[model samples]
Target chain A: MSTTGGAGSTALVTGASYGIGADIARALAARGHDLVLVARSAGPLGRLAAALETEYGITARPLTADLSTEAGLEAAAGAGLGLSFERTAWEEERRMLALNVVAPSRLVHAALPGMLGRGRGRILNVSSVAATAPVWLGTSYGASKAYALALTESLARTRRVRRSPVALTALVLGHTVSEFHERAGIPPSPPSLTLGSPYVAERAVRAILRRRPPVVCVPSVRYRVLAGLLGHLPHRIAALPPLADDFTVTSYGAPQPSYGTGEPPAGGPESAGGDGQDGVLPAEAHGQRERQP
Target chain B: MSTTGGAGSTALVTGASYGIGADIARALAARGHDLVLVARSAGPLGRLAAALETEYGITARPLTADLSTEAGLEAAAGAGLGLSFERTAWEEERRMLALNVVAPSRLVHAALPGMLGRGRGRILNVSSVAATAPVWLGTSYGASKAYALALTESLARTRRVRRSPVALTALVLGHTVSEFHERAGIPPSPPSLTLGSPYVAERAVRAILRRRPPVVCVPSVRYRVLAGLLGHLPHRIAALPPLADDFTVTSYGAPQPSYGTGEPPAGGPESAGGDGQDGVLPAEAHGQRERQP
Candidate 1:
């Protein structure tokens, strides 16, 4: 690891309380970077901060705020930003826009100038595989992610126009084992999604620091291949817009069924609800029914 | 022409006073869709509304409002919508987000459900070719277009999830001959930008009405081929995140220099100053400079 940060090198990571974000925090801490960990809930963030500090001997401070509201942006601006997800309702849509789209932009807006002045900075925005195209979900989530990728692209360009190499990388991730879906009350993505989260953090950090760096990085060889194919697939065939298991038009207050791995479990339809518990529909799962056409 | 709207087919167009947006309003009026022409200024919009009403015999209402504000969205919500843009300023960036990103999403939010209920409707959002990847522009315009395209993609999926074929088409436009650059105080893209605005409007309406329309329609044949290639080009190569002309990093208040169509202009840099009355960079005017290799 080039370990970009020196004795006092500091990093700001949002959504640091859990899942892929938590793993990223651990990884960064190992790299000897002091961290300002941001998330909504204080308990988990606090616990994670303590653990990281104790384990890696790096300073970790947890800040609890929504990150989607004006106050959230202000707080995050004072600190710095992770990202990711969904639901309906105008309220839900608004929240998704603020968190997934606005917050990250604001956080980056805040932290970027300093890095540019110093002539070296790295920003890793966590986006989903679903961001590349549309998926069958509420209208806002994927769009929000698309906003992130676009923002990162624009900012990176902004830096480049000035000949600044302060890097901004979009981590176009495939599904992984994170509390992401489960915490929202939806089923977990089927195992077919990815090997798991440990690999994601390790690969993401590596990609962000590569010599030429990257505009976007899809971890896991399988997903890298899939992302490449998806890019080339005819737009019509490649995109599978809004649909859930029962073919219901999921909208405000609809039952949101997550897609699972396509292979039917030995226990039949009884095994794969995507919940990692029950109601499994392996064949339809294809593991990626959510995004794959 | 399937001129779908009769009793209430009022097509509200933002930025309707000039450029591609004005052309679209003209085309829609020609197709028998009543028009609600919107722009920041009333004079031009009023004149166009009168002219369209006189020429096409369709109702044209000129509604002047700053679409970057809440009041603007409220006014547009009461009417219906269309879109288009360029430029930069902190205020300009906010307005760009409001118009290009927020406005379209809001307009769609206001108009979509009603269309789905009727089992038909057409939404054509004007986005840029630059949106496919990043360009060297130092602003929010490209990112906002990205937001529009992603929103359209998700909404298209939403309707499909319900099996409702409400048409949603993202017009992925290339640089066209319009007052766009002039209005922004920048030189016109060399004629190579694409066949200009007249083609842009006519082709856009047609694409939105195709029996099997595409999620994104790059208006010209050349651009369509290019968009296809971009989708397949290695992501690293497809996106060139920095620089317009000099390897200088342009900024908010800095003097903005115009990039020629990648060739030395015949009249030298002097002939390319932006206005129609002066420097015309047409023959050598490839609207966009290919990313400096």
Candidate 2:
């Protein structure tokens, strides 16, 4: 922790009411940064903001808005939230574009001038490994993430050319222990394949501080290699019967759910239907309950 | 070559008045398939329809409507044009998505059942290589292409599950000798890097006939390898100074004259502009032209 001018650093995080976004908010708050948390759920955002202020002695403001809509983005930015980078909407396909592509972009546009004037700022867009690989099941989600990565790269290039201290980093993440899977109505898998919440949070904060442009593949390096290899293989080879089946979520556990109609859990506007739980753990949990099953 | 059911086969081609779409229409017509040509410009479409009727003895119906708007798509489909997937979007990013993603999807939704009932149909979507790789300058354009590829894959997967002979192929093309460059206000580079219009048309038609999943890096084996490698590389590594330049078009040369801001070109959308006006020639001859200047 470099403390040169660290007392008043501020960060804004979107989708901060729950999941990876919430965890990232906590991690950044713990690092002595004042926080502005944005999410659609007012209840959860308020709870998390109170908790962060109590635990970290950092100023935490809870902002409720749907970052996917243009109006929502305007309200979030107009609240005078200073952030190193905005991280929100880790999942949810439709909102993924709104939150990941449009919202982050609008926020960045709002923050750029301030950061440039201050001469040193970091912007980390939390993208997923799915962005790089063609995941059949999450087509919209993956495409939005791909756009996020591309946008990050473009901004970084612009910064480099202008010799600006404003840094843009795209943290291409892997499967992490978060409420993401539960929201999607899918049980988490084994720990070896997934990451713990604390681990993901810490790594994300550190990368933001370091301004690293990383395509982070957690737990296993093999996935990174596999994602790369799969992208190159011919469409026929990549879309083999076995591979396609593996990519799709065929069953949640018997009593086969409807193919594409039913809503998910984690009740919100887009919820497919289970319970609206705050933090539902994966099916099999090991050492830490926060780890992805 | 395979005349199994050629006589009654109907192909619906969007933006078929000129360029690659027109060439594709011609190729399919030559193979004895009836055609439905769709474009915003009625004049060129009408001319092409007449020419195809005269030259190949295939019925060519000209249905002029902007495929980007919902109303436009409805009108075109309602006109009772033949069904074939010869869809391509020439310019304007948002329109590209509307035409390429929304309209075609709706059209497919309307036409798929009949094709499935007959147990035979070929749908070919013309997507540029830019779909897989991000183009810095053409952000929206690239995103739209990405959507097309994803949609194609999804449709193909769905069709497979129903055991339908409806084949959806995404032709991931590279640079080709078309008017696209001129319209884009960019000078043409070496012709070896570009395929002639006829060559692309022939290869694309052949691939569609076979119902290939997605054609990538057409005419150049090298581009296939390149696209594969780029897709796999980490964002940081991929964002290195040298590679970024190639991925983005930094500046436009000069704006070409257009008839109207929102209107499609005279004969459908003119393909990207290029220098040579000689009608489609062999790829080798085009290569010779490149070496000259």
Candidate 3:
């Protein structure tokens, strides 16, 4: 694969219906990438694909598969026709593993050969700060993120040996104003305390462009320091009842639902069509979404 | 459920065939605690139990069961027929979670009531230094240990709130002279470079008694410092080419046989009785049969 610096690359983003994933999709498209957006909801993906295609002139394909299942991942990987676990009892757990671990692994694996053949590519995994935190409230979510972090690290490490320009970047995000909080069942913080979607999107894109291995707690240096310090502290000190209580309250008050039912806000950029002949939208169209006033 | 200080108590240890697990069992026994030793192979468990009972005058029991599967953990958790994997998985996961994220939690849960009632108790989890390091190579093992570290921290945090004298300690260990290397298909380094079994056993016992939470690296303080450094470094730098090469070589060099095998050296500890009381063969005799010269 020949590595090109930029402007003609293809990017595939999962969980791209909305929130950080949507923002990432937009950012990559703006930077001239052909996009494949994956999520369970078809409504948002279609909206996103259309917006990207019209606005940025990039090909944006929407794949509405529940990515947390083996079959879903296998299909996404283009491995073969596989059975879906839609009727399985352990569907929830299996889906989470498949989406968070297996799908990403397979997608990266599948995309790597092509990326390598082209000589340059970037895989930006939108991971959460929960990966490093020891809070138990979001156990599965945190563990899966940890797996992503490790996998990304491993890929980044090994890629150097292969001399591939495939950059694996994990964005360790904190609370951003997105559907994630709503899906998680947690109320959004006051406007001053919350992060905006546009800013997060911009930073994520920059990290990928710059090939940062991992970004911990974007826009807040203090939180990053705190996470690092907390991770290193003695288990006894960290486990102190008062501290644990404080941490649980501060870092994990409640789970927020990450999905929302909605259409993209109207008057946004048009959905772009197939391939290279498309024209780029003006950068000013990337406006911030309104949240709790 | 009542915790008496180290004055008198009992602990049941699984996977006590050899290596760190066995050393942990011995360490607890040496502290005048009664012991229940469990392993799939009855031979070493019996022998180790016998030696501990004979030397320390502490009662020792041996029961064989594989811990990774439900049937095994169920037997060890006691034959209460009402056990459900749903509740039991949570409970066991909570306990071994530190073994994986939940062991320290369960220990604190179990030890707190007793420790609070008597105003003192101690629980030590034999964790690896790998808990903090990136698991680029030893993925499952490192992930499990990370869970251990998290649970330990969670419990330690809980201690401060309850004002309980239940001390939770995590002995973050490095490479040592043990069968773990052999089982994991790791070749032993030079004698001076490894922590002798006796040394680790004694140090672990002392740390537990003192309620110290130490990130330990056997034989070299350098390894602890190195681990600390690696844990904080950005994912990219930590996964740099040379480091990745070194890690991959060391971690995946020799393939390990599956976890359990019943065979033991002829006329050695593996031939000992199941009860543990009558298997106190001399250390020299056991060593000659088990260790390669």
Candidate 4:
């Protein structure tokens, strides 16, 4: 490791209460970075913070905040993680947009100048393979991820960042074993296709600490190959009905009336369902039904 | 022409007050489609509506509204158009997200179900080459367009749209002749590289009216070739210093305090700077300063 932060470096991570985010937090803490962990679940965040501080002998602060709202953006200016399922109600979709799209842009826009002034910093935005594949049709989640990936890559290419010591990397992750799927009420994926959280975290932390980290990182070798192929695949071939098990689109009944009131359905605010684990593959890879084509 | 709408098809176009959008409205009207033209500027929209009605013998309803808010989205459920420049304040970025990202998603979400029900509707989202080539570093405009492009393609691949007659096409436009640059105080581009609005509109109208239009449309032949090459260009090659005129990133002074109040800067609302013409090439292509690389 280049030890970009060395010992006293402070790192802020969002969705750090569980799954990939939690593992990443642990990895950063072990590297001797003071940590600010942000997530909506207070109990888990607090517990994680305490555990990290005790285990790694470093400062760890738990910040409870909803990253989708402006107030949340103010409270935790550089924290973000989210996902969206297919066939969600308009309410869920809106929340997804705020968290997945708006939060990342706001955080980056808010953090970059200061990072430039400090002459050193690193931003690692965890995006999904959905960013390149665009296989999920029913939701805007993939599109939101495209924004994250594009923003990170574009910023990295800019003259200011190119000339400076700051680094920006978009981790285009593959599916990982995490609470993300369980929380979304999704069935588990086959063990063969899933990745472990600890492994992903190790790759992520290593990438960010590199002397000149790449603009885009796909951790596993298999996924790196897949991402490269998907990049050049024609829209027609990609749109085709993939080999039965490769990808699929399942409808969860009719889409809820997304127009009308644009209000939350009888349910109160939809749960903040998208955790950092919503990465890689299509629906089948995520354990959804086969494509009906 | 498929004549999907035949003589009385109604097309709602946002940013119809001027530039490529206005030209598109004119083309649709000439094809005998009744028009609902939405824009923030009342004068231009009204004039265009009047002229189209008189010239094409078709109904043209002028709807003046901003498309970056829920109320705006509600007022014109299918209207969308806007752009963003680099080094802008937070307020401008917010509006860019609204118009460039939110408006298209909201409009498509609001209009899709009804279109599917009708079994005959066409959605044409105007995106820029920036959607594919993220050469622009300082603004989220390209990322926003990536959202627009991804949404259109993903939706087209969905079971519902694929099985039905509803068509969605994202026009991956290159730089075109329009008032967009002038409004943002950007200098004119090399005449050789810029395209005329009429040709682009004609191409767009034709694509939407096709029996089986493509998911993406790069209007001009040269741009089509460029978009194809760019899609496959390795990030390292792309990240390298391009041949002087190919691309450049210029800093517009220091970025404003994007985090402070998140309020309008000392100035009121930043002008809705992005129009449909913020397409193709990068900073230099758009007539900005050469990159220092």
**Candidate 3 residue lDDT tens string, B1-293:** 01332535556554456654566567677667776666666777788888988998988888776433434542221100011111122223222221232222222333334444555555554445444555233123343444444444444443242355445555555545534334434444444435555565566556545533332322246556756776777656765644432233343444322212322211100111110000101100000012110
TM-score of 1: 0.75
Model 3 in CAPRI terms: which quality? incorrect
lDDT of all predictions, in order shown? Answer: 0.49, 0.46, 0.43, 0.57
What are the candidates' individual DockQ scores? 0.29, 0.12, 0.10, 0.39
**lDDT (C-alpha) at residue A107 in model 4:** 67
Better of 1 and 4 by TM-score: 4
Per-residue lDDT of candidate 1, residues A1-293 (tens digit): 12243434666666565555666667777777777776666777888899988998988877776554667663321110011112223433444455555555555555555565666667776565556765433354455566667766666554352366566677776656534344333354566654565577667766665554576767888778766665556545655431121112433233332222211111000111111110000000000001110
Task: Give the per-residue lDDT digits (tens) of candidate 2, residues B69-188.
Answer: 646764221110000001112223234334444454455445544455556666555454545543332133343445445545544553242355455555665565645555445455
Q: For all candidates, what are the clash counts?
A: 23, 15, 43, 1
Q: What DockQ results for candidate 1?
A: 0.29
Q: What is the lDDT of residue A43 in candidate 2?
A: 81
Q: Against the hidden true structure, what lDDT does model 4 obtain? A: 0.57
CAPRI verdict (incorrect, acceptable, medium, high) for model 4: acceptable
True contacts kept of each: 0.47, 0.06, 0.11, 0.51
Poorest lDDT segment (10 consecutive residues) of candidate 3 chain B: B280-289
Best by TM-score: 4
Considering only the true interface residues, what is the Cα RMSD of candidate 3 after superposition?
Answer: 9.3
Please give the ranking of all candidate structures by DockQ, highest first, separated by commas.
Answer: 4, 1, 2, 3
Q: Which runs in model 2 stand beyond 4 Å of their true positions?
A: A1-9, A67-70, A73-121, A134-140, A154-163, A177-187, A215-293, B1-5, B67-118, B132-140, B150-164, B178-180, B211-217, B220-222, B225-260, B263-293
